[model samples]
Target chain A: MTIAYAYGPNPWPQSFWDARAAANFVCGGAGAGLVVAAALSGARGTALVVPLLAGLAIVACGLAAVFAEIGRPLRAANVVRNPATSWMTREAIVAPLLFACGVAGAFGSLAFVATAAALALAFVYCQGRMVHAARGIPAWRAPQVPWLFVATGMAEGLGLWLALAAFLELRSARVAGWLGVAIIARYVIFRIYRRGLGRALAAAPARALDAAGRALLWGGTLAPLVLLAIAAAVRTQPWAPWLLLAAGLCAALFGAWLKATLVLRAGHTQGYTLPALPVRGTRA
Target chain B: MTRWAMVADLRRCVGCQTCTAACRHANATPPGVQWRRVLDVEVGEFPDVKRVFLPVGCQHCDEPPCLDVCPTTATRKRDDGIVTVDYDLCLGCGYCAVACPYQARHRTPRAVFAYGGAPAKHEAKRHDPARIAVATKCTFCVERIDSGTAQGLTPGVDPEATPACVNSCLSGALAFGDLDDPGSNVSQLLRENRHFRMHAELGTGPGFYYLWDKALPEAAQ
Candidate 1:
């Protein structure tokens, strides 16, 4: 049957073209820089404050990008009001509250309480749900999306703080331990997403997406591993954190790029279906 | 409840896309915006394959994650089961877009203009342009329903009873009616067909139903 359907408006503005491009560069690049800075630093008071502030800034900028992409800005606050069931709502609530907690902890106002650890965890979880809620995009909807996002956030946070310690000429094996953990996480997520890509590769269209993912997993992730090995071998050299910092930066960029590429390549499919057995129909 | 549903018969559907065009015209939706889309999927390799056309849109589910994840409560499912989005209340957060398992929602950009012939420009009005930035999808013509009922006409139908798409359909493949109605064609079709919802593993429980062609090629089998 020739059925009728409706169309809606595209909400983008002329200015959005420039704004989005800028946002991608700054958020994607500067965000990685901040993480590297923090990871090279010590677990001192300054180490906590700078990364906390930078993390908050990252979230704000991320929200701005989201707003720019959406045509509406005023209704952004409403998501928090409906937090009972909405992951978006939950994200809105959790992002700020965690930021507030992190700020308080960094400033030493909430040091005695368990607020810091809780906020850090909350931050990670919120980051995860942002991608997990999209049921339509199978790549984003994978069970591993949340784990990947949260783990990356934590790893980035740790890498940034540790990088700061090294840059500041402070000593801490804890920083190396953290970088090690982040590398491991990046590897694990890459594996999981690889499996998902295999499932998605039924169509020829998904080849580019698969390739982008592979690039990030190999070049971006392995870059840090080489740096880490060098640092471990020459323990006396103070540049180990710097090398780890570079690796962290690459990992964040390549990972986010892989995600964005995969998301953009996604085409809306026939509604989610169970495995269907084909019937002998018309021939090509 | 207003549970919105549709049934498409593979045997009858000609894949002309009358529904797609009518929907665009009725809504005056800008270019690049299709409230409904038909996916032409070709399955199998070489001699083993066949083509199938599938129409998709919002399923208005029983457990709507879109509504659940909308922090602003901008998106909601009516008691009658029709899911509607309040554009003015939307924050353009993209959270709904991400949360929707069906990937039904799209985040509108900050500015909107009519497109087709050329890039038409719009003068700024009093309302914030950000209102359009919110997530959007098919509202099932609720405005038509409200106005139609007020005028003593059945919404989505006439004495001959048909929706725009159903009325325009040349092959009589599209069927729409209350799934709860025992006499409804949609209900009968559902009972008769070996149908399924996409990605049941996601547990979205969408209202749209698909009847696959028994003659589909090896890949789609």
Candidate 2:
């Protein structure tokens, strides 16, 4: 018998959704973030095309991974039937819109870029709410979860944009400044999510979230900030772009790691809790 | 409007698990799946410890979170408040499973028998093709309720109309009836007993009520 069926009253990690679900959050966040950041950065011509295609491809990979996770893949169309109440359905609707705009923006015009970015942001928002809709899992059901996802996605996307900027030799201090802001914002949201949980989560989930927060603080937040700072200081140097690229990679990869931990390791289901225990034969 | 509900009296329970066995037999659920089960919870520390046999399953809440989060519209609630799953439409995405706080949802991707290999005669006969790769849960014996009620039988009072678990309960601890009916057996039980729903603060408005005489004196006290 499983621990759940046997012991029955303790929080345990949910097996229904595994690492496959996390792939959607990680890749989808980074991809959507890249689209939004690229549009906001004002990349024109080939500069815009490269990042847009890359972002769409990444998002497509996430969609494919989730498709593999569903038991009835043929009945996938049924997911779009309830957009009125289901965030997953809303996400399904937004993905195609994002793709259409992304494809058009790659070769069409700057207007398409803005449109794709809006759709991409909506897609990430839907994904965040999708995770939040898992009311059984305390760690995922935080009201701030959607905001956390948005901030982290923007931070990761900005990191990817900066890394690609290094490759494409595109420089914009204003966008880089936003990246720093996003990273710190993500850290702040993570802290709030943890504090809000406050004994509501099981021991295992609480520890897992704390460990992820620690990693986000040191590697994802602090390290990236220091690198971006140094890159700004050495703006005149020929190798400053490399410093920015390294910072971008740190931010994006660490964000991916934290989300993976959130979905897989910290996804413990709420166990049974009786407010007042009843003693047999007690009188009213 | 008739609303189906259940009440479990803590004073009368014996932790025999007869209800669990009966439910599994009636449903012919795959191995490792129990539609209704009792949780043996040992609370408090050392000197004043007490073990409570907590019966749990799908609460079939009035505000079921599972119904709202279903991406495929596979999970539904009847006008009577009994939540159900449409096996044909479900993609088994598990969103409803996670949304359900009761941990009541079950999904079987492939056919598996009680024994190691091959299907027994009874297993093959009971195997539902549509159940494969779909989300499932306790339906509160909807088939019995519908068929029995068609003949003008009232649920909770008639054995044929009641849920299999409530019928098989060894100690008469489990009761099921229309919560909307003030004169119902479950309603009388609720009126006299001090009871509470599990996780009521979550705002699910669960129909499953646990009745106790009074709060047990804490061991620390």
Candidate 3:
């Protein structure tokens, strides 16, 4: 039978992990980043509650998507069995603790919120490692993949916070400044990742990542940075908060877009390559 | 101590896919899944071209990436060095599938018949519900190996004990035996001819070896 996916020098898009898998990375990373962003922004008590709970909810949603993706949902607990080697196991173990701190911080103290943020960071790190563990997928196994995930998660959270700040009526210019800084950092890391990847990726995903990189620069990075700058200049204006919200939305949404692209579009399996071909006439 | 391995004399493989057919008949894998298949690769320019029929499947690497990445501990390597999966324990998360560089692992969401509609009588009878939505792959005929050994038969020498693919090969391209046993057929072949393991630089220490040349000696091997 002619297979849709041919194992050859040219890599083929992997069919195993699909949109549901991408949803986990997208939602999970954003949620983890939001917690870290709130913590770094010095969100305390009442200020911490909204973002913390929201972040936790996002994380839960991501986990739920993953649960739905697995073949044997009843045996899902088995995923936690190999924490010693599998990063997915580590993520599962940490998820509940992260949720615990998130809930406690919702009605408890700032320390709980801070604890939640630390755990969130750990969860995101596990996600990065999880993707990296797929050695058969060349796009995922890059050493910088974990770093990219961590950076994107934090950026998404901070952006969400900046956007949420407008509604909370507890807007801070300092937080906006931090979001800008985070955006710059994320963009830098993304560039480095792409550069390191060079032409290693298959043609299709390489083009996709390049396109994402471009969008990330204009929509995810520069546009948001410019909006933040403009919003800061007109801080007293009635429409200033809206611009801040827009910038935050742009940053957060684009981070998600990047994650989605990486997971879904760039998930190409490592195709076969032979160092040397056997001569047809040879015999031992 | 018996490290089960296979040696593919690449020159001898005709790319006729007799092994592939035998494997499918033995395993009863689904329509899209081919646990053992040959990759016909052409090298060099058009005029100077040469083709090599590479028999590729689960390498059964010593340091199996699939085993380490399996979240549910479903994939395990045996003492005799055969990697097998416990379908009951597997969540079919596909992590191991993607972790395997050989692309040896496979998972299907449901029972897909060879024909479009309802399953044929034989297909329905052979359908393993436990295998549904779980990772499956070439087992190297572990059942045959274990049972045959219990019956006092050596795997490589005994037809009943050997893998169906090895037994079915018309070209005598495929050889299987204990790599640790230097006097074994595979070991003897390796000792006589230069060979290379696929993706060896990845430190997988693949159980599959390909003998490419007789002109090259054991020193090159």
Candidate closest to the true structure, highest TM-score: 2
Best by lDDT: 2
When summed lDDT is taken over every stretch of 10 residues in candidate 3 chain B, the lowest stretch is B212-221
**lDDT, candidate 2, at A67:** 90
User: Against the true structure, what is model 1's DockQ?
Assistant: 0.39
Q: Order of candidates by TM-score, top first?
A: 2, 3, 1
TM-score of model number 3, chain B = 0.96
lDDT of 1 at B72: 77
lDDT by residue for model 3 over B7-38, one digit each (tens)?
99987999999999999999999887889999
Model 3, A171-198: lDDT tens per residue? 6687788788888998998999898888
Tally clashing residue pairs in candidate 1.
70
lDDT of 2 by residue, B44-160 (tens): 899988888899999999899998889888998999999999998999998888888889988777776888658899998998989877888899999999999999999999999
DockQ of 2: 0.64
* Candidate 3, CAPRI quality class derived from DockQ: medium
